[model samples]
Target chain A: MTAIHTGELVDRIGEAVLADPAVVRLDGGPFQTIATYLPGRRVVGVTAADRITVSVVLRLDQPIPAVAAALRERVRRVAGDLPIDVHVNDLESKEEPV
Target chain B: MVTTNSQNDLRDAVPAARQSPAPARLADENGQGKTTIASNVVQKIAGMAAREVSGVHAMGGGMSRAFGAIKERIPGAGTSSTAGVSVEVGEKQAAIDLDMIVEYGASIADLARAVRRNVITAVERMTGLEVIEVNISVEDVHLPDDNGGDEAPEKSRVE
Candidate 1:
């Protein structure tokens, strides 16, 4: 199978992860600062490895473990059989304004 | 690599593409040119949609609303409709995170549901980008008496 371009692969993985209703976003988190120092390292939380690692923030309403597991499968489909690292860095509130 | 039971479970959790279809990328190709929707565009759209919902008193949390309020006071700094809205826009899909303050007495569950539906509809219709999720964060509540400008006046000084 032809390997996808790194950027393209990243985009695809992002799409897959976001496709889930429970996913909030790929949280910028602390890695946001690295982009400033490392100009081209904009795709934070995504690492190019033999397998990839993905870290994200999720909506609080769903079960965290289940969401993380689902993400692994999603990431694998887009990036090939890569072992993804899913981190639940933050949780968005499920309740409305009180 | 050593795989654990949880990893195996995760492996099984990936749904089939047909079952959970990926969002279609927004494409404008006429063999002449193409158009793209910027992330900011989606952000603004989401913000507007949330604002359109009646129970939404304001966008952003306390500090952000404070800053947004201050920004509005400046001559050229028009109110930022996108203040509380953040988006992660992709080739075919976009995800939105909103921090909002609701008017008191509104049901949180019902309002969130309405806001999510409205935001998804508005963003998808306008941008042609499928909104995968709209995460709402109810940062604060806006009480009727909380309007700083509507405070009862003190005894007339001139009197």
Candidate 2:
């Protein structure tokens, strides 16, 4: 298996997580701790280390656990051997206010 | 905070017949992830559902309703949909409490029942969280004559 760089891995995971319809946006965990600090920019809500952590705000249309499970599955395909931690920090309604 | 062993224990506790029909609703140990639903989301859903019932004239007690009226007049101070609705949401279940004003002549008991059913259905279906209980409190009754005071304000002496 070809090893991917940490920076690239973070981007890949971010893209994958966002592709899921249930996820509204990435969230920086408490105090903005969960993130990947790059040269000039940092990706919020995703960190790569001993274990990968991703926090997100999800839409309320689906079951929370089901969405979490799907997210982990998607991240796992990109992350390979690293364990993943998914945090669903908040939920948003699907309807738009008039 | 959920560990693999605890998930295994939960799996073992469930009846075999029940386990075969559906996937587990709770988070599993296989690194699937953890999901937390904010209480306010459930509160909003419950509030909307309660208002859908015919007899519910409004939500909240006298003081809150008065406050809500004043808040509505201010720019960018939109009315709170969750007013008079409180919810406790757990990983897999939720409980809701509602304060409501009913229209006069409506049967309180029947109205409560209808509101409870709608709230449970809406919350469970929308959020996928089991609504264990919905407690309804009828705070007041809205009389038709009561609108006279609210509809017409006293003329200002200066104006």
Candidate 3:
């Protein structure tokens, strides 16, 4: 029941994050910079039907690919068959000096 | 905690120091004592629900995340975000209050309705959490897509 649903929920979010190109975009997305917990923290192992979704504020100037790849790999390692969607809310580009 | 008899009452009152209280099961899978999966679970569940619509920006509004972090510093919060998302253990049901920012060009009523339907369908099918209400609050609308960077769009989504 609830336990199962929660697992599915985690998987879906992961998928959603992985699917979004913008999420992978380095300059603006939070993939590498953001602190991931839970499903994100469980990246050491993989499971069937794994998907995850994440959100973060990232430096907009960087490319999003690294974040996406790292995230996907992490989710795959921990929860296999997982889909992750990571959305960026606030982005600060490195082009502009902090 | 309830005890049926005097012996049981003694056991309950005694607070068995020897038995390290079972790790608080925030959300267990296969009774393996898995608590590290609670926040990500709720966050992702809500994320799946929120993005189906055209306008949603992300989960955890400034206020909620801020307060959630604040609550984290305090000892009482067993888990973050769990307080917000409600659940029925046996029924495997859950509900969430969604906050979103609608983009320009989409109809508020139409977008909200579409979001509601999608959220319910996705959450129920994927998580088995019976969403009681996909209540939506359109927080803000950004500059129109045509308005160009930094400039306010000709028309506002909310107005």
Candidate 2 — which residues are off by over 4 angstroms? A1-4, A29-39, A47-53, A60-66, A81-87, A94-98, B1-23, B64-79, B144-159
Query: What digit string (tens of lDDT, one per residue) describes model 1 on residues A44-75?
Result: 65554464656565664454445656777787
| Candidate number of the best lDDT | 2
At residue B2, what lDDT does model 3 achieve? 20
Q: Please provide, for model 1 over B63-140, each residue's C-alpha lDDT reduced to its tens digit, 9 standing for 90 to 100.
A: 878887897777434346668888997756789999999998999999999999999988776556678888999999
Runs off by more than 4 Å, candidate 3:
A1-98, B1-40, B58-62, B65-91, B145-159
| Model 2 / residue A17 / CA error / Å | 2.4
Model number with the top DockQ? 2
Scoring the B chain of model 2 against the true B chain gives a TM-score of 0.70
State, as a TM-score between 0 and 1, how close model 1 is to the true structure.
Answer: 0.46
Using Cα atoms, each model's DockQ against the true complex is 0.03, 0.38, 0.03
**TM-scores, all models, native as reference:** 0.46, 0.67, 0.36
- Which prediction has more favorable DockQ, 1 or 2? 2
DockQ of candidate 3? 0.03
Model 3's CAPRI class is incorrect
Interface DockQ of candidate 2 = 0.38
DockQ of 1: 0.03
True contacts kept of each: 0.00, 0.47, 0.00
What TM-score number comes out for model 3?
Answer: 0.36
- In model 3 chain A, where is the ten-residue run with the lowest total lDDT? A43-52
